[model samples]
Target: MRLLIVDDQPLVRQGLRAVFAGLDDIIVAGEAAHGAEALELVRRTAPHVVLMDVNMPVMGGLEATRRICAAGRADPDRTLPKIVMLTMYDQDEHVFEALRAGASGFLIKDASPQQLADAVREVVDDGAMLSPSITRRLIREFVRRPALPAPDGELSALTGRERDVFRLLVQGYGNAGIAEKLTLGESTVKSHVQSLYRKLGVQDRVQVVIYAYENGLI
Candidate 1:
């Protein structure tokens, strides 16, 4: 997969490039020090995924992502490259705004190199990726909100088992942990996760957690 790296720090870019160096399936197509440069690079490289930093001079990643999505929408035949916000901030507002601006996921800088690679691969494969802390924040926010009318499309879509899986998921349980908790085999839990993903139109666990929060399911 062709990849673009967008960060204000040269060291961050270098570290990310070095991380991708070990992955044969990924290629670093371009690098940018700021959002404006990122926009230009996206236009030129047409990368499959962008690892974007949220804070930067001239333009922020959020606005850049918005613009990129807007441009892609203007050209219907072209699919926009997946945008992942890699940042130090895990605040509720930041995550929410980034998602609103079309970020496929958000991760912190402290994530291991393998985690970074996994996040890239997830987005490239049309999936979502959010750090564990972000997932927790989303769940807490969702649970704290006043109950609203649940959408029939979202509510009726989930089966009883799927709802159980989703509840544990929002609480930050992995498939194995969930399986153990539910007294089911790992493969059975995996099947339920896949079904939940399809029913919710979500690509990854993070989005599933976010959906639970947004819909007040957890």
Candidate 2:
């Protein structure tokens, strides 16, 4: 997978580059010192993933992500690169805003290289990633919030069985686990997953969880 690294510190970039060196399938496509440069490199290289530092000169990763999604909307046929925010800030506000701004994943800067790489791969293949702690926090936050408005037209698309599958999904169950719990075949579980994704306009399990939490379905 082609990756663009965006961080202001040379050492941090070097460290990431070293970590990815042994992986045959992973390649460092470009580097950027700040958000503006990152956007330029994104346009030029069209990497599959972008590892972005949250804080930077002139612009921040959040804004860069917003702009990137805006551009993608303007050119709907082109696939937008997955954006993973790599930052020191793990505050609730920061996390909320970054996700709202179109980041597919968020990770702390202190994450191990393996974790970072895994996050990138998750976002690329599954459309979202969140560190364990981040996921916990998100769930807690959603639980604390007031009741969400009932999904008006959208919830009607899901069948009764799909809704049951979705409830397990938001609780972080994988296909095998879900199948076992529901007493269904794994292939049947996979079909339900695909159907849910189509109905909900979600690309992956992570987004399904997020949507469930945000909509107060879990």
Q: Residue 168 of model 1: what lDDT?
A: 88
TM-score of each: 0.72, 0.81
Tens digits of per-residue lDDT, candidate 2, 52-141, equal 889888888888888886787577577788888888868788788778667789899889988988988887765477887887888788
Among all windows of 10 consecutive residues in model 1, the one with the lowest summed lDDT is: 201-210
Model 1 reaches what TM-score against the true structure?
A: 0.72
- What local lDDT does model 1 show for residue 181? 96
The parts of candidate 1 lying over 4 Å away from their true place are 150-218
Off by over 4 Å in 2: 158-165, 175-203
Which structure among the candidates has the greatest lDDT?
Answer: 1
